[model samples]
Target: MLAKFRQIKTSYFKLLLLACLGFFLVSLTLLFIPLYISFQNSIVKSVSSHSLKTLSQTSYSVEFMQESANTVAEQLFFNSTINQLLYALDYNDIDTIISLNTLNSYVKSTLFIESVYIYSSKTGNVSFSSKTNGSGFEHIDDFYDSDYLKTLKANESSRFIPFPRITSNDKLVYSFLLPSSRSSDLMFSNSIMINISAKWLENTYKSIGNQQDDMILIIDSNGVVVNQNAYAPVLADLKEDPMIVRILNERVNEGYFLSSMDGEKQLVTYTSSPETGWSFVLLTPYSTILGSFANLKTIIFAIYFSIMICGIPICLIVTKRLYVPYSVIQNKLVDLEVRYKSNHMVEKQNKLHALLVFPSPFSESQVLQLKAANQFKVRFDQPYSMLLLQIDRFADFCDQYPIRDRALITYCIQNISEEIIGKVVGAESVQIDRNGVCMLFNQTSELQTRLTPLVKEIQQTVRKDLKLSVSVCVAESGHTIADASQIYQTARESILNKFFKGPGCIVYASDETAKKRAGHSEYQPARQKQLTDLIMVGKFEAAKKLLSEMIENLKDAHYDYFSQIILTITLELNNTIQLLEKANELTLPFQFNTFIAKINNMGSVEELLNLFFRLFDEMDAQLELKKKSKNEKLVQEIIGIIQRDYRDVNLSLESIADLVHLSSSHLRRLFKKETGSSIADYISRTRMEQATHLLLSTSLSIANISEQVGYVNSTYFFTLFKKAHGITPAEFRSKYATT
Candidate 1:
């Protein structure tokens, strides 16, 4: 189970599914949070605004009614009949009945008034009219809400005040008390009380505007509910209530707020009537405001939950489908990255090579190449030196190993060199060619002390592991990146000093010995003329002696001058051979071109000296053979004349015999007896030999080549060339030119 859990945790499918689900949830949250906030704010604002507006209208209406009540009270207070009835000390049944009729008439004049009372404090008699009872006179103490008389008498400063009272019919009424006199002794004065039914006020409050579950109240300055539509009792002390407390503390004539009342949230809007000192409070429960939002929220949540329930599987399917291509692309990207890394390394190697081989005082492209190499961490902007390592006896090395082994061997050398050098300094080693590996060393402090030991160690390691030898050429320190190419070239040139230094040696380009022999040449024209003179006069012993001495002398010189010495010698020998052939002087059968070709395969100067000695012996043997045969000499004379005149297209056997001072028939018989072919055949053979050489060696057209080879007809020459080499001249050249 644990393993399975681990597998699931690491699974690509699981990761993708989780990612999709996370994104979906985050998107929903992002969309829902702000939407919820905005919707809630809008709903609250709308409900509060509507409730405030209703409260305002209700307050205005109540204020209007209070003003109307004040107007009625003013008119009633000024009436002489009501004043006479209240101030009269004694009265008959007629007078009392007339005063009751007047009170009844005043009550009937207003729609909100239920009854009116006129009280005479001197007699303690109250005359009252009611909608339910006929007009009558009674003591003020015996009246329903008769305690209001005490409340009215106690307030001296108030000429008129409103009070709530309950009648014997259990109906609510608001009584407005008006004094008949302004004297401070209110008990001695007459007063009037106008009763307004709470039912009428409630109906008026409802008529203005109200909502179901909405509470409306009219609270007086003493924190008592003057009129109650809902939520609180009539005349209840509601100052401690949360909603009422906030409303009262606001100290503003009108305002709205949200509060919690009876464990339910409510929007409370209140307005105060300045004339009545009564605050109109509207308590709207949040349930009413959020009712529509609740339905919308339900629908939205249902849809959202359904989508979330269905989206899991959809996300799974989508993740599966997407993961296929994603996996493939990821794998392809990995492969591309691998290839890119491989190509990047190769590019770095190529750029480093370009920097090493670039000309001095670097060009723009070479500078760019160096900069590119620096990007690869192959920096040359610091002090550095070049080490050129060439596998000694590279020709022999090739003869021993196959191509694969050679590559591995080269790689081994480069790895070992770089690894060892890397310990002490920053270095980059690149295999420049088959036999050469170049290393750039970035640490040059104590230059000689640092490089000498490291270079020797690298040589020792290569020789010990590979059982092969290498010659290392270390160039002088270069101060800047631009000096790398020149320093590398100097190392390359100095490495050739290995021809004298032999294998498994390190040669410094800055060494005094190497510097002294930089441009000095040991071989001279006088030595060549003397060697040629010895070979021409049939003095093989003296010529052999002279050749050995020259080879010995060249061994001590630089390899550059050594090569020049060999070249001059070979050229002189060819001239001497041509001189001998022309004068019929020494008929030495020397293949000089073949001999020159053999020089490259020589591993040592001793081998080269031995090769030259063998050449002299072969020439001596051929000279003795020529001296021994007279008939052979005559046959050779005829052959030589034929060879000399092979380019003369008109030359024949008779022309050849005339040049040799012999008759045609006799010359033909002598050539057949000694050479085994006719003179005419020999001439054709010679011309064909020249034609094949010219075809392979020159780019001239076949017609011009044919003319040079004594064939004026290019077609005949082409046929002969095809027959000789089993291919046409063009085909032969194309086939062998690249090789």
Candidate 2:
């Protein structure tokens, strides 16, 4: 038994050696190069796709977080408790200790505030407290005082005031200011300061998740790193990377770059909080995620080698069986080819390889002669109508289905086409194009009568069976394959006509109607003259009437030229009316009503024509007056009252309404109708204008400006200013120097 087993093993070893050699040869000839290329392409595509998805997700998360932070900041900046505390301190009736404690407690509970401080400009007193320690002003010189406080006071409309500083403990902190709500006439103005801790920022960064060793950082508009998880990186070190610096300065929301810290390539996604003027960044490393695909390549290679080894013996076994049958099939195919060439007739060719060409009816004599000489008969001689069927929004359909599913959809369409053609006029060849299917039919006069039923049947098949919608266009019977391209063009026109008439209906192409509609003259000169006449005198009512009349005339005549003319006139009239209304609301000292009256009273065509030129000049003058009077005061009585009672804590539209002896709603309506601005907007604008002058000229701090401008909360005041000016008061002052 042992000797017999050894003999069998020797025979198996010889076969295995032969199989290995064949596998190596086949691999070298066919599989290795193509398989390696396909593998590499798949790996690169997969990595790129995942990278893009990760970048997109990271960008969305950062934007969402930044928006949340801005909302929280806005709420804290507008809180009334901080406003009252600052107001009391500015009045000098309360001690700093009491105000600071109240503010610190409010900050701790209301916001994620870690520390609070109050700085006074008059007494040079600064009070500060944190969860760990409480401190009072030790040396007046120890506090860094610049024009920053004065600037903040001057502009009461700013919300978040960012200042970078290194604390006594040698840790970087971002200090935000909340100015006091006190009048500029007061001797002192108090400002609330909040110190943001790195730990507090850790809470914001926690949402970014772990993306390798890459760290998330928050930076201000000035490129200062306000919060970073990485250790000991200065503004200069952060700016060393050009992309990071660009993101900080330009507020680019999402991008990719290489880090300077470790020289590792990364996809960096960023978003700017327009409210705070700070940027948030999320950085992810590339190699950490894409490296795993390398292992996949090794596995693919092993499977490919095994397949090649197994395929060698299988090919050897199949070759013997296939040789005799393949030789017989090859000889038969050669004989058929020779017979087809000698006959020179498509019908004589084998069924599998036959090509069917529909000959033109115009060339019937020559086609018949060729067919008869080759022992083939003409299939049909009657005139035929053509139908073009197409799907709407085909590109959208392609996007919804995967490639394999799309192939199935095409196959289904082909099957349906065969079924329809077989039922109507026997099974015929159908040509598929990018838009839809093209079919030829032999029944000439019956096309118009039978087309409706056929179309209904096609619609039912597509909707009920294939779950798709299709539109069909049919050409008249006089058309044939000789005029195939022209017939197709007519069918396309018929489909477009359905867009105007309604959908799921068939249209027959009429050459006479098409030609008549195509050659009409366009009238432009008369329409232009009419529009110019109405706009010059600001006769908006008459202009609207003339435009409506023109549109009706275009529709009645069914002229494309008139339609174009009416569209142009309507657009011009709308724009002119809007301009005139805007000018009147701004209280420009121009007689637009008088000019309109003159245009309306014109008696002759010549006079009306002359008015067109004069109207343009008058409209131009009104626009100039508008630009000059944008800040003009038509309602001076209301303006003076608002300025006087601006510091009143209960000051509002209602209070002003009572003082003026009118109802609140009535006053608001009248103000907006005459001024083109709502009551609240007018008040806010007045306060902001006053605050701007004070910031540039006065020595008052931000708190005084807030009270002087009628804002009970100085932080609210700053928030409003930053929204208007696109920067904090201190930054605004640095940008624009006052003499």
What are the TM-scores, per candidate, against the unseen true structure?
Answer: 0.38, 0.42
After superposing all C-alphas onto the true structure, candidate 2 shows an RMSD in angstroms of: 19.3
lDDT of each: 0.76, 0.56
Q: Quote the lDDT for 340 in model 2.
A: 79
Candidate 2: regions farther than 4 A off = 1-50, 61-381, 393-415, 426-436, 444-448, 479-481, 511-739
Number of backbone collisions per candidate: 0, 13
RMSD of each: 57.9, 19.3
- How far off is residue 225 in model 2, in Å? 19
Tens-digit lDDT track of model 1 for 338-391: 998898778777877777876554454665565675644444555667788889
lDDT tens digits by residue: candidate 2, 501-618: 3334555566424644666444555766676577656564575466545544443232234335545653564455555555453212234455455533433223433554454455
What candidate 1 gets wrong by more than 4 Å, as runs, is: 1-337, 360-379, 399-405, 445-447, 512-522, 537-541, 581-589, 628-739
lDDT value for candidate 2?
Answer: 0.56
